[model samples]
Target: MTRPLLDQARIHPAALAQIGSYHTDLIAEVEAAVAANKVVVVGMGLNPFPAKARKILDGQGTPYKYLSYGNYFSQWRPRLALKLWSGWATFPLIFVNGTLIGGATDLQKLIASGEFVRLLG
Candidate 1:
C-alpha cells in the first residue's frame, strides 16, 4: 500500500533540496537503528503510548531498540520531521524487521493474531 505524496514536479526545484535535507540527521538515526535492530520503537518522552509499546514487547520477551525524542513541552520541530519522514503522524512508531508495524494497539493486535511472532521469525 502506497501513501500518496506530493508530486516532486509539483514542488519547486529550489525548495526540493531544503525539503530533502530537513532534519535528515534525526531520520538517519532512526533508519540506522531500524537497520541494526530486529525491533525498533521511535517515540517521545512523556508519552505513555511508547512506554506501553515497550511493555508489550517486554511481555513477549522481545528485545527492541527504542529511540525517544523530546516531550510535549519541547522539540516539536524535530518530531515533526519524523512524522513527515515516516508518514505515521504519531509517536511510538514501531518497526519489526525493518517494516513499520504501527503503534501499540496495532502491535497488540498483531501479537494476539500470532503475526507478530511470525514477523520476528
Candidate 2:
C-alpha cells in the first residue's frame, strides 16, 4: 500500500543538530511544526509566495505559523542549511500535517485540485 501524504517527509532532530549551523530554537520550532497537525510555512520577507500561502490557510480556516528570514540574501547568511534541508530554492517552504507539501505554487495546485482539504483530513 502507498504511504500517506502526511507521512511523507519527517524532520529528523538529531540530523539538524549535526548540521550545527542554524540556531537551536529555530531547529526546535521546525521540529515542533513538523510534528503538529497544523500547517507551517517558512519563508523570507518581500515574497508573494509566503503571503499567498497564508491566504490559502486563512480561506480554509486553517491556522499556520509563518517564519521569515527578512530577505532572500539574508536567508543564506544562516538558513542555507534550511534551504538544503527543504530542497526548495524559493521563499515559502510549506508543510502540512508534518509533511513538506512544498511552496506557494505547489500549495496552490493542491488547493485548486481540492487535494489540500483532503490532505488535511
Winning candidate number (TM-score): 1
lDDT of 2 by residue, 15-42 (tens): 5456555555666777787786478898
Residue pairs with backbone atoms closer than 3 Å in model 2 (clashes): none
Compared with the true structure, what per-residue lDDT tens digits does model 1 show for residues 10-91? 9998899989999999999999999999999999999999999999999999999999999999989999998998889888
RMSD of each: 1.0, 7.0
Q: How many backbone clashes does candidate 1 have?
A: 0
Off by over 4 Å in 1: none
**What local distance difference test score does each model get?**
0.94, 0.74
- Name the runs in model 2 displaced over 4 angstroms: 1-25
Error of 2 at 51 (Å): 1.1
Model 2, residue 74: C-alpha shift (Å):
2.6
- For the record, the alpha-carbon RMSD of candidate 2 to the native fold, in angstroms, is 7.0
